[model samples]
Target: KAEVDTSALQNEAIQLSSASGHADVVKLLLKNPRVDPSEKHNFAIRRASMKGYVEVVKILLDDERVDPSVLNNNAILLASRYGHAEVVKILLTDSRVDPSADNNEAMLWAVENDHSGVLKVLLGDSRVDPSEQNNYAIRRASELGYVECVKMLLQNSRVDPSCRSNNAIKHASENGHVEIVKILLNDPRVDPSACTNYAIRHASENGHVKVVKILLQDSRVDPSVRDNYALRHASKNGHADVVKILLEDSRVD
Candidate 1:
């Protein structure tokens, strides 16, 4: 006969078992009336989700006693951050889970970590707003050179590439992500000249020859916009290629 130890020890064991992906043990522990699955600030579920333990999360969610949205929707956020696409999908199906909670932090983590699968899942959720948090998702993805993630975010009609969310183009150009720069420019909504020449200046300072050339080629981007800032930065950084390219632009003073 199995004796029920309804004490604090039982709860700890449940958490440990859940975190370790012991789905069977978690199911057994949840059956006990004295054991609390959501105890300890939802630690068990968060750990399981963070580690991509889909079965463990499923078991916890089935218990009805477990709450996925508590603690700032941490389960979804952690799962997205770790690229647990399946886990994220499961959580999104629950009505209690808010995909846009905490200012859509889940999306932010997904974009920043380049979790393309997780991002795709989030985008499918009608409640998720890709442009939330001041378009932080695309900006961060662009800056980090997460090409796939940026592409996914851009596909969402709700996202305005030209919204000027912290000047994503500038960040992309500054980080020397040439392909990303081209993608953003293709959107037509994004103004290559929006950042007062910071985009070109940053690319020039960082010696990004390809990025500077691309910016110069855009008719909308005036090469001389920032009082020759780009030229000075290229010369100061000793980027002979960038300097040459900028000097070739008749607009650069």
Candidate 2:
């Protein structure tokens, strides 16, 4: 009878977790020796964590059996993806939790969602590398014109402003993020002219006047160094404004 009762309570707790994400029910079930807090049920505490239920998370985390570093669970990744700032905070503070886990997936999630607040928290921890490669966090944030995130990433001395990527300056210029373009331009290490003709032509053709102006003013930029392909593209696309700017400069014509 006791075993059946315990199973019933555990089942009820799971249902409650699924619907309400309440900590009280989770705690009650956890108190039963037969109830497995870490059970892989659909409505487990881990899922609650992903849903941003801080109270339920605290209850689950208190159990010695719960692994704070677990990843890829719908709950954990969802929490990160949705910008559950508080849950992320609690997880990171755990001694057993790995801040750099999942290839810094949490950071990428925060950036993709444009969660500036959560990003600030993650950035404050030195263990989180702002310059990690190929993740949408850095590139997407720059593309989306999240200036604060860009600044935070730039603050890391190890972050290479000129990190070569198809989307780097091209995206920034096309989006009319003048400040980001300016920041990239000022970085001595960034090769503003590295991308293919499409990127340059796009920047030029869009009449991103300020971007063109900045690029032209840079002494390092070879106004005459035309990648034949890009020049033809600019002309073919009928970006007359860009062509005019290019032609106005004696070096380009």
Candidate 3:
């Protein structure tokens, strides 16, 4: 017979079982009507989800008494941050789960952690807004040179390719992500002169010669714009190769 204990005992057992990924123990404890799923800072499901205990998560979700929506700093958010794709998938099935909740903060967490697997799951959900302003996902991905993540986010129809906040192109250029720069530049909506022509300036300052050349190829980019900030940055940073390239542009005053 399953032992039904007091609230405190049940809470402790549930927390330990969930944290340890003890699916069997969790199942047994959850069967008790006295066991509170929301106990212990609402960590029961969050811990299981974070650790990628798919079976445990399924068990918890299946219980009619369990409030799957208990965010507890976002169970899905924690799952995504830790790169638990399976766990994230389970959470998405809950109708109350908000992919864009907390200002789409979960997606930002996934991007910052470079958890593309979890990101993919999150992006697939129509509910997840890809264009949250200054959310570090795209910016961080571009800066760190995560080509696939950038591509995925771009393909999502909801995401604006030329979001100025944490500008993707500028971050890519600043971090010397040549391929990413090319990708963003190819997007017709993206403005090379956006962010006060920071794209070119970043490429120049970082000595990303390849990226600089790519940006210049875009006819819309006036290298001499912003008092030739790109040129100045290249010179100041001692990026001789970038400076050489800039000098060749007739637009440079």
Candidate 4:
């Protein structure tokens, strides 16, 4: 009968620690000689650490049975994704922790979610590669107009400006980010004309006349590129003024 009650208490302590990050409860449970600190529960120290409960995490780490090396990459990954900077710092300091591990997927998650604070930590850790793109962090930031994040990524020497599925320039241009477009254009590695035609078509089709005009100004941009859709789009979208500009270019009869 006593054994059953102790078991129930241990389970409850684990639950409480997982949810509340209350170190007091955990310490009380640890006092029970029968309670196994190392016993794997659905919620463990890793969850507490990810939640930024520094005190509870410290208690769990002090337990001889508790393994600091436990790979809760998913939980740590979530913490980083949500901008839990302190939690990430604790996790990364463990010698067993692999900052560059998981094929850069964690960094990708942070980037895609616009967790700029987490991204700074990840990017600063030389272990993390900036070009890893399963999450398309840089391009996604540009597309969503997260200008500060985009700027940070671009400033990183390791980040490949052109390394993307759609290319940052095209994404910025098509999304009507004139500022981002200008930034990408200034990079020597970015081919001003790389996706100009496609961007022009998309901008015109979407009635983003200002974007079209910006692209046209690029000396590399071929205004004569036969983009029937652009003309058709301008006509359909009631951008007659833009249509007039295209008509005057002498590219369309």
Candidate 5:
């Protein structure tokens, strides 16, 4: 039978040390004969990884007793989600670590949180699928107005440049991300007509005159399409600048 009292104390000490990011405490505690570092769960490593404790993580990972492959509460996922780029890099060195594990949730979390530093590391790895159609990192970055993130994802050949199902251009326009709008507009694959009048309408409705001007410059975008949707939205929303720009198109009825 396990020494219940000793085991409880060890577990509590390790967890606290890991959570507090005390590398010295973790090392000293691991030296205790009664402490079972070999526990399959490896709670210490997980906590250290999640908290971005680089030294603590390294110490825990070096222990042969700690298993990095345990599926539940994945260390890499947590580290990536929290934007711990250094911790993630350290974890990736272990053959046991699967950065792409957990259905690419690590990458998705990195994208969602705008962890650009972590994202660079993740994108360079062959294991990360930047173009996972279902996850759509590009779409998420575009919608969130992460221009740099979007640019990085676009470099991956797998990612579709066109504003497809995720409405990359539409969301960027709606949120008035002018730079992102410019980038998407410059992509040949992106059809301005793809979102119907969504791009101009949302830009107008939100009173984004600059974005409306950028869209107007795109010869592919017909401002008067959808029964003059841009004009109606700009007029109704009291966006005089956007309305004036739309009316100048000469196609507004």
Candidate 6:
């Protein structure tokens, strides 16, 4: 019974030390052959990854028995989600680690949460597919105003600024991300009026006066498209500034 209790404590001990960056303690605990990381689903490595404990992660990865890709690459996901570039890099070096694990969720979290560094590292890995979900990374980054992240993803040949239906510019314009909108426009592939003028309507309805003006400036965007949807929404949403801009457009009746 005593041995059974000690075995249980081993997993907990490693988890605590790994999470706290106690690299030395983790090493000592691992010396005991009974400390099986897989017992708790390799959570200790994940904790270290999430905390950006470079040394702790390296120590754990060095152990041949440790599997960093367990639980659908949860370790890399946590590291990428938390913007731990160093931890992600170390984990990638492990032969068993798949950077594209869990359908490339690690990169998605890094992109969505504005972790450009981690995203960059993940992008460098050929295993990562930036365009896996129809250019999801670029669109989300544009919408969230993550300019740097958007730029990085845009440079990736696989990513399209304007995918089949959903577009990065459309999302950016809707949320008044001026910088991102401009960046997307610079990409010739992006059609500002991709979604039946919904981009302009969303901007107008949300009272994004600056974004509305930017859309109108683009000759390709039909201010009066969708039966004058942009003007109608602006009026209904009580966006006087946006309404004024729309009225100035010759196309808006």
In model 4, residue pairs whose N, Cα or C atoms come closer than 3 Å (at least 3 residues apart or on different chains), thus clashing, are none
Cα displacement (Å) at residue 48, model 3: 1.1
TM-score of 2: 0.77
**lDDT tens readout by residue for model 2, 1-253:** 4345654655565546634776677777777787666554434655776678888877777878776555444454556777788887887667776555667777777878877777877777777777777535556777888887777677767666666553556688777677887777666776666654334555675656667777777665554555544345557877676677777777665
Query: What is the number of backbone collisions in each predicted candidate, taken in the order shown?
Result: 0, 0, 1, 0, 0, 0
- Flag clash pairs in model 3: 71-74
lDDT tens digits, residue span 137-239, model 6? 8878988999999989988899988885656787788889988987888888888887787788899989999888888888888989888888998899899
Candidate 6, which ten residues in sequence have the lowest lDDT sum?
1-10
Flag regions of model 4 displaced more than 4 Å: 1-12, 31-33, 49-52, 68-72, 164-166, 240-253
Model 4 worst lDDT window (10 residues): 1-10
Q: How does residue 168 of candidate 3 score in lDDT?
A: 79
Instruction: Please list the residue runs of candidate 6 whose C-alpha ends up more than 4 Å from where it truly belongs after superposition.
Output: 1-10
Work out the TM-score per prediction: 0.91, 0.77, 0.85, 0.80, 0.92, 0.90
Q: List the residue pairs that clash in candidate 2.
A: none
Off by over 4 Å in 1: 1-7, 31-34
Q: lDDT (CA) for every model shown?
A: 0.87, 0.67, 0.81, 0.69, 0.82, 0.87
Segments of candidate 5 deviating more than 4 angstroms: 1-6, 38-40, 163-166
Write one digit per residue (lDDT tens) for candidate 4, span 1-253. Answer: 4354544655665656655877788888777777666555435665775676877766776677766555646546767776787777766775655666677766877777878888888887888886775336677777776776788888887776666434777777777887777777777776645654666666766777777777777777655566566677778988876687777665654
RMSD of each: 2.2, 3.7, 3.1, 3.3, 2.8, 2.5
- Clashing residue pairs for model 1: none
Q: For residues 1-253, could you state the per-residue lDDT of candidate 5 as single tens digits? A: 7554444754787778887999998898888767765454777788788899999999988788887667643888889899999998998888888777766788899999999889988887899898775547888888889988988888888788663643888888888988998898877888656667688778888999988899888877788878888888788888898888887887777
